[model samples]
Target chain A: MTKIVVLVKQVPDTNAKIVVSGDRVDLSAVKKVMSPYDEFAVETALRHRDASGGEVIALTLGGAGADKVLKDAKAIGVDHIVRIDCEEELDSNSLQSALASTLQEMGAEIVYCGKSAADTGAGSTGPGVAERLGWASASNVTSVGFDGGLTVVAPSDGGNARMSVNTPAVITCDKGDIKVRKPNVKGIMQAKKAQVEVKTAAIQPSSVTIVAHSMPPAKPAGKSYEGGAAAAEVANLLRDEANVI
Target chain B: MTELIVIAEIAKGTIHTTTSELVTAANALGGSPIIIVPCTDASVADAAGTIAGASKVIAAKSDAFAHYDAAAWAEALDAVAPQGTILTSATPQSKDLAARLAARRNLSVVQDVVAISQNQLTSPVYSGKAMQTVAISGPAVVSVRANVFDAAPSTGSNEISVVDTTGNMATAVQEFMARASQRLDVAEANIIISGGRGMGSPDNFVHLEAIADTLGAAVGASRAAVDTWEAIPHSMQVGQTGKTVNPNLYIAVGISGAIQHLAGMRSSKYIVAINKDADAPIFQHADYGIVATWEEALPVLQSTLAGMMA
Candidate 1:
C-alpha cells in the first residue's frame, strides 16, 4: 500500500486587502483559508486513496493557525492530520528543508501538493522537497494515475506530456478536470473534534531574509466613457495612447 | 566575482527568446553571464553562443535530455553547472530544474523574481497582494519572471564549452498529446479578453472570441464563468485560484471584478472594463472603464478595433 501525504498551506483569504505597515505585511485582520490549489491536491489524494486502497495523510506547516487547514483536510476524510510546529519565519531553503525532513520521518512513499501556494505564489515546495529526498517530481500536473505505476499528465510547451515514474516521488497538482468535493455535515462535525499531531523539525540556518515589504506603485486615474458612443474613442485611444492595438 | 550561469530555455528542441531575457537579468545583477543549454545534441550550443551579454555558452550535452525528466535533468545540469549564481526564466520546466539544482547543492532558491535591486530580490507574496523583497546572503539560484526586467544593448562573442553527462534516466515518456486547437493560454498571452457569468450564456463568449481573434488576444474566463458553464475549461480561468497573468492589455467584459479575479491580472499594463453596472469594482482598477452592456458595446468595439487593425 502506498503512504500518500498531501501538503497544505494556510493563506489569507483571496478577498482580503493586504496592508503594509513598517516593512511588514499586516495579515492580522484577514481571515485565513486553505490555499485554493491545495484543496485540489487534497481532492486528488483522496481519490487516489479510494481507488488504490492507500491511506491519505494531510500535512501542514506553521503554528496553531495552520491546524485549521489540516482539520479541513480531516473533515474531507483524510486518514490522519499533522502539523510542523514553528512560529518563526523561515526562508525558502529552511522551509523546504524542514518539510523534506518531516516527510522523510513520516515514512512518506508518495507526496502530493499544489502547483504553488496562493500565499507566496512560490511553487517550490514540491520540487524542492523532492530534490532533498532525491525523488522524481512531476509538477503542474493535471492527472496522476496508479494503475501499473505512477503516471502524470503535465502541461509543457503548449502540449500535454504523459510521464511515468517510480515510487517515492512528489506530484504538484493543477486544477485539471477534477471537480473538488465539499465536506458534508457529519464530516465537518468529526473534523471539529479531531486532534492534530504536532511535531518539531530540525531547523537550519536560512540563506535568505525578507528585508522589506511594499505595495505595488499606484496607477494614475483612468479615463471613463459612457454608452456605446464612446466605443469608437476607446478603440482610437488604444492605438494612440496605450499603443497596444 | 561569483560566476553567473544562465540555464537556457528550450521549447520543442529549439531556443526560446527567454534566453536573452535571462542574460539581461544576469547582466542587471552586475555580472557577465555564461549560458548553458541542456541538450543531447551539441548543435543547440551554436545558437545560444550568440545571445548578447553572455560571456560564454556551454552546451550540457546529455542522454538525459531525451525528454523532460526532472530527476535526470537536475542530475545532468548539476555536473556542468559550477558553484555560482544560477539564473533562468520562470517557466514551468526550468523552475522545476532550479529548485532541484538548488537542493542538490544545498543552496537557496528564489522563484518568480520580478525585480532585483542592490542585491535584493523582490517577488509577489500573497498572490500579488503584497510584494516581498529578500536579501540573499550568498550564492542563490533565482528564476526571473518573464517580461519584467528591462533589456539593454550588450556584447557577446563565441566561447563555447560542451559537457557530456550521458547517464541512465529513470522517468519514461509514454506519449505526448498536442492540443488540437491553436488557442493561446491566458498565462502566455500578451493580450487577453475575459468574460464572466454576466455574459448570460457560454455561447455568448463567441463575441469575446471574435474580438480576441481580431486583436490576436487569448480568451479568458472569470471563476464565475468557469463554474457556471462546463464548456469553459478551468485553463481559461484567470484569477487567484486560476492562472495568474501579466499581459500588456487585459479586457474584462461583463465581470464584476471580484478581488480574487483582480489579484491575478492586477499586474497587467493596461486594463479595460466593460460592464452595465458603473459601480462594479473592476472600474476602480481599470485604465479605461465603459458603462454599457456587452450586447451594446461589443459590436461597436469589435468593429472599431477591426477597423483600426485594417
Candidate 2:
C-alpha cells in the first residue's frame, strides 16, 4: 500500500478575535480547529488514498491542545494519527527540521500538506521539508492528477501549470476546487475513541529571535453613506482623494 | 554593509516586474545588490542588468530552468549565488524558493517582509492578527513583498555574466504545461473587487468581474463564497487561509466582511464596501460604505465609474 502522510495543524477559528498582550498573542480564549488550508489537504489525501490503495496518516507537532484537530481528521476517516510531543515554541528552521526528520523516519512517500499554516502563515514548512529531504515539491496546487504517476496543477506566473513530478515528492495543497466532506455519525464515534500514536523529535535552538509583537494601527471610523445614492460620491472620492482610479 | 543578493523572477520567458521592486527593496537595506536570473535564455539576464540599484547580474542559465523543481533550482542557484543574504519577492513562488534556499544553505529565511532595515525585518504573523519584528543576526534569506517598495529608477547598463547550470543540476521535475492567461492574481493586482456568499449566487461574481474589467482589477471571493459554491474556486478566495492582498483599491460587494476576509484585504489602501445589511462589519473598515443590495448598487456603480473613466 502507498504510505501517505498529511501534515496537519491546529489553529484558532477564523472568526475568533485575536488578542495581543505584553508582547505575546493570546489565543487562549479562541476555539481551535484544523487550519483551513489543511482541510483541503486532508480532502485531497483521502481522495488519492480512495483511488489508490493507501494508508493515510495525519501528523501534527503540538500535543494535547491539538488532539481535537487530530480527532477531527480521524472523524473524516483518516487511517491513522500521530502527534509530536514538543513543548518549546520553535522558530521556522527548527520546526521544519523536526517535521523533516519525522517524515524521513516514517519513510513517508508523497507527503501532502497545506501551502501555509493559518497560524504562522509562513508558507515555509512544506517546501522546507522537501528541500531538507532532497525531494521535489509542488506548491499552491489547485488540482492533482494521477496517471500511473503524480501530476499536479499549480499556479505559475501568469496562469496555471500542469506539471508531472517524480514520487517520494511533497505536495503543498491549495483549496482549489475541493469540498471537504463532513464527518458521519459512525466516524464521529470512532474518532472520539481513536488512540493517538505519540512520537518525539529533537527541538533545536532557534537562530532567529522575536524583537517585539504588536497590533496594527486601528483604522479611523469610516464614513458610511446610505443606499445607492452615495455611489457617485464614492466614485468622485476615488478619483479626488484616493487617486486609485 | 551586508552583501545583499537579489534573485530576479522570470515569468513566461521575460523578467517579472517584481524584480524591480526587489531591487528597490534591496536599496532600503543600505547595500549594493547583485541580481541572479535563473533562466534558459541570456537576454533575461541582460534585462536584469538594466534594472538599476544592482552592482552586477549573474545569469544562471540551465535546461532545467525551463521548469521549477524546488530541489534542483535551489541547488543550482545556491551553487552560483554568493554566500550572503538573499533577497527576493515575497510572492508565493519566491517564498517557497526562499524556504528551499535557506534550508539547503543552513541560513535564516524570513518570508513576506513588508519593511526592513540594516539589522531587522518585520512581517505579519499569526495570519495578520499581529506583526512580529525579528532581529537579523547573520546571513538570512528574506522575501520582500511587492508594491511595498518603490521601483528603482534608472534602468542603466550594469555588468552581466552568464554561467550555465545544467552541469550543476540533478534534474527531477519534468513536463510543465502552462495554461493560457487568466485574470491577475489578487496579491499582485493594484485594484480588486470581491464578492461573498451575500451575493446569493456564485454566478453573480461575473458582475463583480464586469467592474473589475472596467478598472483593470482582479476579482476575488470570500471564504464563505468558496465554501458555499463549487463554482467558486479557492484561487479567488481573499481570506486568512487564502491570499493576503495589499491592493490600491479593494471594493467589497455583497461581503459582510468576516474577520478572516478582513485579515486579507484590510491592508488595502482604499476600501469601498456595498452590502444589503446596514450593520455589516465591512462598513467599519471601508473608507466609503454603500448600504444596498448588489442588484440595486452594482449597475449604477459600474456605469458611473465607466462614465468617469470615459
Candidate 3:
C-alpha cells in the first residue's frame, strides 16, 4: 500500500490582528485554524491515497494546541493523525532533519505539504525534507496524476510545466484547480471522537538564531490626487518621486 | 575580510538581473563576492564576469546543468563553495536549490532576506505581519527578495575561472520550458496594476491592461476577482494564498483592501487605490487614493499616462 503523509500547521486566522509586543508577537487572543494552503494539501493526500489504495496520515510538529489542525484533517478523511509535541523554535535545518527522520521511521513513500507556512512564509520545509532524505522533490505543484509514476503540473514564469517524478518524493502543493472538499456531518462527528497520538520529537541544535524583531519603517503619507484629471500628476510622481516608471 | 559567494542565475546564456541585485546586496555586506555561474557552456562566464562589484567568476559547466535540476545545481554549488556564506535570488528554483544546499551542508538558511548586515539579517515573517532579524555565526545560505535592492551596474571587468565536470552528475533535467517571452512576472515587475471584484466583471480587466501597457506594468487580480470570474485564472492572483509581490508601484483598482490581499503587496514601495467608496479599507494602506469609479476614472487616467510617457 502507498503510505502517504501530509504535513500540516496551525496558524492564526488570516484575518487575525497581529500584535507585536517587545520583539515578540502576541497571539493570546487570536484564533488558530488549519493553514489555508494545508487544506489543499490534505485534499490532495486524501485523493491520492483513495485512488492508489493506501493509508493517509496527517502529521504536525507543533505544541499541544496544534492538535486542532490534526483533528481538522481527520474530519477531511485522513486515516491517521500524529503530532510531535514540541514548543522550541526550530530553524529550517534542524526542523527538516527531525521531520526527515520521522518520515523515514514511518516508512512513508510519498509526502505532501503546503508550499509555505502561513506564519513564517518560508516555502522551504517540503524541499528541505526531501533533500535530507535524498529524494526527488517538486514545489508549488498545482495538479497531480499517477500512471506508474507521479506527474505534476507547476507554475513557471508565465505558464505551467508538467513534471514527472518517482515515488519516495516530496510535493509542495499550490492552490490550483483543486478546490478543497468540505467535511460532511458524519465525518465531523467521527473526527471529534478520534484521538491524536502525541509524541515528543528529538530537537536538534539550531544553527540560526533570532536576535531581534521590529516593525518595518512606516512609509510616509503619500500625496493624494483628486480625480481622473490628477492622472498626469500621478504619472509625474511615479516617474520622478518613486522612479518606478 | 570575509569571503562571499554568489550563485549567478543565467537565462539564454546571459546573466539574469537578479545576479546584479545579489552583487548589490553583497556590496552592502562589505565584501567583493565571487560569482559562480552554473551553465552548460563555459562562454556564459563572460557575462558573469561583467557584473559589477564581483571579484571573479567561476563557470561551473556540465551536461546535467542544462536545465534547472535542484539536485544537480545544489551538488555543483556545494562542490565549489565549500565554505563562507552563499547568496542567491529568492525564486522557486533558487529557494529549492538553497534549501537543498542547506540540508546537504547542515547549515542555517535564511530565505527571502530583505536586509543583511555583517552578522544580522532581517526578513519578513508571518507573511509580512512582522520582521525577524536573525544572527548568523558560521556558514549559511541566504536568498534575497528580487527587486528589493538596486541592481549593481556594470563597472569593472573581472577574471573568469572555469570548472568542468564532464561526467559527474547525480540528476538530470529531461526538459526545460519557460513562459512566453516578455511577460514580466508580478514578483519581478517594478510596477503592477491589479483589479478586484470592484471591477464588476472580467471584461473590465481590459481597462487595467490598457493602463498596465502604458506604464509597462504586469497585471494582477485579487482573490475575490479570480474566484468570482472564470476568465480570471489563479495565475493572476496576488494574495495570501497566491503570489506575494514586492513591486515598486502597486495600483489596486476596485479592491476592498482585504487583509489577505494586503499581505501580498503591502511591502510594495508605493500603492495607489481607486474605488468609488471613500471608506474602502484599501485607502488605509494606499499611498495615494482616488474616490471614483473605474469606469469614470480609468480612461482619463490611461490617456493622461500615455500623454506623460509621450
| Predicted structure with the largest lDDT when compared to the true one | 1
Interface RMSD, all models, one decimal each? 1.8, 2.5, 2.5
Query: How do the residues B25-127 of candidate 3 rate in per-residue lDDT, one tens digit apiece?
Result: 8888778899988878888778776788988989987876765656666777788764778898887778888888888888778998999887888998877
In candidate 1 chain B, where is summed lDDT lowest over 10 consecutive residues? Answer: B149-158
Off by over 4 Å in 2: A184-186, A189-193, A221-229, B155-157, B167-188, B197-206, B226-233, B276-278, B292-300
Model 2 lDDT tens row, A70-162: 999999989999999886777778888899899899888879999888877888888888888888888988788776788888866556667
Model 1 docking tier (incorrect/acceptable/medium/high):
medium
Clashing pairs for predicted structure model 1, backbone only: A119-B126
Instruction: Give the best candidate by TM-score.
Output: 3
Which portion of correct inter-chain contacts appears in model 1? 0.76
> lDDT at A36 for candidate 1?
82
Model 2 docking category: medium
Query: Cα miss at B18, model 1 (Å)?
Result: 2.7
* Tens digits of per-residue lDDT for model 1, B106-190: 8999988988885899998887878999998888999988768664343557589888885446577788877745788887788
Query: Relative to the unseen true structure, what is the C-alpha lDDT of residue B216 in candidate 1, on a scale of 0 to 100?
Result: 95
How do these models rank on DockQ, best leading?
A: 1, 3, 2
Docking quality tier of model 3: medium
Per-residue lDDT, model 3, residue B27, is 85
Where model 1 places Cα greater than 4 Å from the true spot, the runs are: B152-155, B167-170, B178-180
Candidate closer to the true structure by TM-score (higher is better), 1 or 3: 3
Candidate number achieving the greatest DockQ relative to the actual structure: 1
TM-score of 1: 0.94
TM-score of 3: 0.94
